[model samples]
Target: MWAAGNVSDVLAAVPQSAGAGNTAGGAINMDLILEDARRATEAREAASATPFDGTMEAEVSRRVLGTRAHGLEGPA
Candidate 1:
């Protein structure tokens, strides 16, 4: 039951998990579980710095992938 979706439960009232704190159930440790969310947030922040906009993607395709990507070339 302790999951990322449990934030509403955590905020609505004192989290039972906070008191549990890796000692009682051993099923979910909030500190360890939240690390994944932290990592994902960091990855998102890093990606935001240099997003894949279409203009750059097209240039890379033209320069690197070349006309091979244009399957119509064989027909035309």
Candidate 2:
């Protein structure tokens, strides 16, 4: 099935009716959700200004080489 369909199935299977007063405690809090979305958008925009290439690869290389590259090593 499609990804959306799978997500819908997973959401539907959650125990929405098992909480106190049959209310779904796991339901989305729109205010908190909106705040999170706003923060994520801001973070993405900030990150777009200073993009790094091969960041993960560089980290792995630092570990393997046992050298302090890209500030990955412990403080002096």
| Cα misplacement distance, residue 56 of candidate 1 (Å) | 14
Note the clash tally of each candidate. 0, 0
- For candidate 2, write residues 1-76 as lDDT tens digits: 1122224354443353233213323234555688899998889778834345587666667777665655477556
What is the TM-score of each predicted model, taking all chains together? 0.29, 0.29
Query: How do the residues 1-76 of candidate 1 rate in per-residue lDDT, one tens digit apiece?
Result: 5543235355533455455543433555566678889998889878744458887678877787565666444222
- Output the TM-score of candidate 1: 0.29
- Candidate 2 has a TM-score of 0.29
Q: Kindly state the number of residue pairs that clash in model 1.
A: 0
